[model samples]
Target: MRWPRHVASLLLTAVLLVGPPILLVRLVGWPSIDSPQVALWQWVRDPLTEQNLILLLVGLAWLLWAFVAYFVTAATATRVWAGVRWLRRLPLPTPWQATATGMAGAAALTIATPTAPTPDASHPGTTTTTGTDHDIVEQADTADGVALSGGWLPYEVAEQVTAAAGLVWLRRRRAYRPTRPHRHSQDAQDLAPLPSTVAAIQAATGSRPPPPVSAPAAGLPPIGFPPTGVGLTGPGALDAARGLLITALLATLRQNTVELVITRRAVDILLGPAAPHLRPGAGLRIVDTAAHATALPADARPSLSHGAEGGRRVLILDEPPRSSLANSGATMVVLTAWPHATTWYVEAGGHTRTSDTANAGPRVCVLDTVATTDLLTVTGHLQPPAPDTPTQPQPQPQVRVPRPTAPHHDTIRPDKRVLVRVLGEPALLVDGAALTVRRTAARQALVFLAVHPDGVDSHLMAEALWPGLPGQRLTGRLYTTLSELRTAARTAGLPIIDRTGDRYRLHPDHVDVDLWYFHRAVDRAAAILADPSTAWQAVVDAYAGDLAAGHAWAWLDPHRESTRRHVLYAYAALAAAAPDPRQALAYLQDGIRVDPYNADLHHRAASILTSLGEHIAAADLTDRYTRRLATAGLTAEGALIRGGT
Candidate 1:
């Protein structure tokens, strides 16, 4: 019942071809293979031409042949009709079988029969030509024109010959060249020659060097943003938004560190034209977020409008002000919803309700690509707390700052240490130990280096992490933090090599950053797959652990996607490169599990199953893939309805 459409189509076609012949035999009688001569003679002879005894035998033979053919046709036709009906229940090319059959027949005819040239007016005795008029005339010959082809030619041939001759006749008889009208030299010369003498002053002026050119004024920028009020305007905003969203979706490349997301609709709208350039291996994770059918906010209906631009950064869409909608939390809400992997949280009546309860972490920032303009209005300037703002200490707290009793070197040790600080705080982990970081200035200094990783400039670092601190004071703080961090590392038996001119780098072997591990695995897999023989072992070992457990930082999604993609790629390569079908299927199955949404993966799995003669499994996988796609909101482009059936 769940037979593939192709299989059903084949059965239907076989029935159509075999049924007609059998039915004709049953209704009119066909010659039997066993008694060929008698059957043939009886079939050809007129109904009235036989004796009574012969007629009775012929009638009996005819009846028998009719029964045989009828039974065969009826049985096959009934089975095939049912198959075709079943095929029509799916959303696929159900009737394409008929078209395919027609095409096949046409192709067979074309290949089987050799083409012959059409009869020429001059020659009048060849076959059909698939050439043009000029060619026909050029190739025709009076010598080849023998008796007018047994009888009259088909009407088409006659017309072709007549048309060719007419075209040739027209070519020979046509001519429309323009005549040159005579011009009087006396009248023409006097009117045109206003003199070489007048060129005297012009020559003197032309001999002088041209004045130095001045730079032209810059013109106004083009109407850069999309007129639809989508935040697609700016110098590179459109390009940036696309890259950002794509990167976010495909965070596997970035290990999911970048926080950006887009809706399926957004992907479709932006990527439809550029679909050809979309690389499947680029480690993009574009998930369908169209499942949310929730209504818009109560007070803020999303009205598309533009905002003022901030240099080359902002994309403003100009629109008439909606006074009622102004100042509502529309902008933040919209931007947050713009991304697929997004959820919201609200605190009301002393309780917090979160939309993303399934997600393990709390939400930090929301990026709304919708008509929400709140973010566009937020000025990035950080103003100091008001002068009269009194910072209140916790009511129950009376604390003294803990002073280090041990030497600076001993106090900075790392051992089974857990260092917690703000994102930019300086917390060091040496081996398996953690170092106590001086809160604030010293902690931030360490974090700046960790985040930058490539080594920040000492001057720039001083200015940025400790903005208002004076030169000597800030440098002293930086040194103190560096000392404590180094001491902690040494105590924990870790490596921290200081470089000349105030530079530092973490030892690659000692520090196991997740980002580094992800890249190593991906790179190794890619390398081996490229050569197959070179880095095979490394590739396998690298992808052993996922973005280290419990470390699904929002920023690491891209990296996660990247790592997952490489794993799949490695598996696929292994499958393809393997000589054994069993091994190939194993690898393909693993890849499928990791990247279930990949169409090519499904195709590969199905192919491997089919190759292994697991037809049922192959069919089932295909059905599963089709259903999965339908669930993702992609409707079939065509209906699979059997035409004749």
Candidate 2:
């Protein structure tokens, strides 16, 4: 229940501000007044006396202090209660806010109480004084005034009252000072302007001006603006230019294309669906370090190294090389993402050179994507070069030798196949070595296929993998995941999964799946029911644990439970066919261990124990089973065993 705001404010005022002064006055043996109102009236009527005058001043001061304290406390209480209501909706404990408020109140009380002074050797008699000199002076002055006025209250008492009141007032003011909230202007200037194509090129290449365009000759049409096609505005213009530049560079490099050294991540990004198609036949070399690039075979084709190169050959760096290309005997050094707009670095005469103009040399071309595209388009229209004259063949001496018969080789040894285990924790073993398949979707696909040997169609696979995704998105993700799985399989020297139409499957001959073996053992045991001991034991041994025990997929639960039921059946068959009672009891116990809640297995074990003359043990087992069933909110299916079975 909550009280009215005025009532709560009045209560708080009486307890905190008015009560403290009243208690202090009482402590000094001041006349005990039952009613605060009567005390105030008595003080007003008898103001001539110093005692009454002091009381009247203290009461009026307290009334003023209470009024201010009441409003401040009421405002703070409203805010705190609102916060409490908000906190209650969260997951926090119920009493936390109250506990926090209590702690804060205690802290305020501690700060309000002045620390008593420690004894000093110079002044041995004044050990109980407060530490502050102002407090001591105030107390001394109050005591002297009370004595001079011949007041009813003792000097020490008056001094104590004044000190307590001053401390309380100071503490209250310090704890609650109202201030206006700060406001922010909506028109604040931005610290930095947005980046633009011109700004980016200038920053990269330095403050050089753009190359001047040559005027067209007389009777020739001026190079009017190339068709302003779609995706040629704003930042997209830079992207389109970059794309064309890359295409031109690749085309030029194809003339003598040798080795292409790039980072794996960069290769993936550049070769993604959105990037331009790269011409085939370039020696695609991926390296994780610059050191690897330096050690590449020199006999390989002309190289475009992402960083520095060691050989004295034409090196096209995608970005500026860390070391200067000067005196390196490089035929050409093309730097992309140049630091300046008008200037670029080049290599010529076995030294690195800087050019501020576009017509510096045939070996240098520092142009953006659009410029590169325009140059390539113009060059493509030129006529073919004249054919070179062929040289006449010269005669040379030759020796005749007998040719030796060579042995013919036909079949090659196959690579070690992949073995996937999903009976327990999912694992992929290639050639007896564990292969870490990091992608979660790829792993899930493998596990799903392992359980369903006769592959699942793409539609069903999609539903299982991404349950709530849209159809188009689901199809795309499924294809990407399947591609990743096939790549991983091939890289590990395992047979790639084959897809017949929309159905994807791993060949049984190449992939030995553990789930298949478990099901095979169970099938064999069912076929040989006459003497099923060996077959059933094989079934038990093949099942290491539940299917995909560690992976959490909703679809996996059904497969896990199905596999578990098969194991339970095998255990039950072995127990019923055992010749000895003890052996049968052991089999039943094993079945119970696999599934503790199987009341049938528990009953069989108990019956075996009773047959062996262990009546007490059998009864205890039955009691335990009964308790388990009750705990699971299940009624016992059979009568509970007493002393005898």
Candidate 3:
């Protein structure tokens, strides 16, 4: 019952062109034959009169012409329509260009019709005598000859073809026209500039912009800790607290230390983030309520323990133990959300508790979001302690003895062995002997002076080291610390600490600090911009650790973070210019170690590994980094990594 549109169209065309002739033949009483060949022959032989036969033949020819024209028009229209759609998608110089192009395409497809031949000069509208059949036949033959002659096409058709071709040429010329680059000065002139104050205000109020995607090396991970503690009582502090707590737990476990654990959602919050970073053989064991009731150790309360080779086993609890003395015998008990003002508590018996104010034996520490982050950063460098093995007895401590004063006029060269290291703990080695300053304030003063070779006035030093203390008391403390430092320096036979009135600075000639060497390397690398491989290597090597690691002095963070940024930039430049993927990966790895929390570095490393056909390695690296981010409650960023993968 149903037919394709093309098939139906063809049938309708055939019926319109061929139906009338068949009807006329039937009406004229032409004899019918079953066989088509016989019917055709019979019709040809007895189709009645010549006039009828001629009419039939002309109708057939016209039908054939109509069929040919129909197909040709359909084909041409299809091509022109396709071209119009294609042209519409392109960026045209003007809106009217598409219309003009469509018109041109339509015109190009138009077929020109032939013009009638010119009138004959000799027989123009002539009256024919032609009463005879011979004359009439000759006149008919002459008319036929005139009709057969081919003539030139119509003028309009020629014009349309020319116009279509010309339009196409113009369109092509416009499409491929070259454009000139704008001058920098001209570009600057076009843009309106804002006042410095207004710009600064706008920048401060605006949302932080996304990091640029110029290169994989542009973004670096956060290294070390912030100077000020990220407060735990904020809206989003809960997740951060959980992340930090888990990080601390993992750090302790890595050190093969045992501790008591108590938490409800330990599996979801702790194990999830720590899973990827855990070394092989580490395990987490849950202590059920029944086990706690029946299997509690006799001499020692249930305690967190490590498997052989320092594999971690966490004992997650559904609730705090009912017995107050439940974990009294535990080696190290960590109580979460315990109420305390000045001291931590360890459970002993139903009403017996011990305060660990001095942080002695089996220490118990309260957990919170801010505290967790602080502890993780402080204990980041702790490694698993090796198995204990007994040997010889310890030697007695030696008494400090001051060296004889050097002559004032004597030529005293700067001791090359004098080195001040502040990357981790502040340490000073004079003549290859490490000097130990016991007081925390004195140590801090020494570090402050070491960092600022230009020397700091007493007021500024007091302000930085002791922010809220009275001026007189601060002066007393500063003098006392300086005296301690001088005594140590004198014992080492070095004129390391020098004072000029109120200003105190390390004698630069008598000591060389690690930070100074790091800066020098960076400067040298910058100076030799042409070939900086060796100098850059020095820069990387000299940065042994973050500036004043584990110390979060208010004034020290900015300088520390600034140095880290410079080191990252140097590494980024090196990676970008590396000749091969291997060299680039090496540079990137060094950067990653310095700033392991940086997602961009991990993404870049994964991309390079993917390009090198290391699919498994790339997946592993991406997975591990994403897990780390998840631990830190950065699921949005983790999703970005997954999407990229």
Clashes of 1: 43
Q: RMSDs, each prediction? A: 40.2, 39.0, 41.6
Q: Give the TM-score of candidate 3.
A: 0.36
TM-score ranking from best to worst? 3, 2, 1
Judged by lDDT, which candidate is best? 2
Query: Which candidate ranks first by TM-score, i.e. highest?
Result: 3
Displacement of the residue 496 alpha carbon in candidate 3, Å: 1.7
Question: What TM-score goes with each of the models?
Answer: 0.28, 0.35, 0.36
CA lDDT, candidate 2, residue 197: 20
lDDT tens readout by residue for model 1, 522-608 = 444443425662343344444544432232121222223334545566676677778888887887777666555555666667777
Give, for candidate 3, the lowest lDDT window spanning 10 residues: 144-153
Task: State model 3's lDDT.
Answer: 0.46
Residue by residue across 1-645, what tens digits does model 2's lDDT show? 456987986787567766766776776544456798986777678758887766666667667766777787898899999999998877753598889988999899888555863332221112242223210111121111111111111122223223322222222222221111111111111111111221122121111212222332232111111111011122222332333233233333333232334443333333332122222233334555433444455555544333234222223333333444331332222224334222333331111123443443111112333322222221221121223313211111121111111111111113426778888888877777777776677888888877666776999887665542346667877787777777777756656576789987776556767777676566556667478788888978888887887654534534565566667777887888899889988887887777666656777788888878999888888788678655543445544333254
- Alpha-carbon error at 230 in model 2, in Å? 58
Q: Give the TM-score of candidate 1.
A: 0.28
Candidate 3 C-alpha error for residue 275, in Å: 43
Error of 1 at 285 (Å): 26
lDDT of 3 by residue, 508-552 (tens): 667677766666556566667576776666777778788788754
Q: After superposition, how far is residue 77 of candidate 1 from its true place, in Å?
A: 99
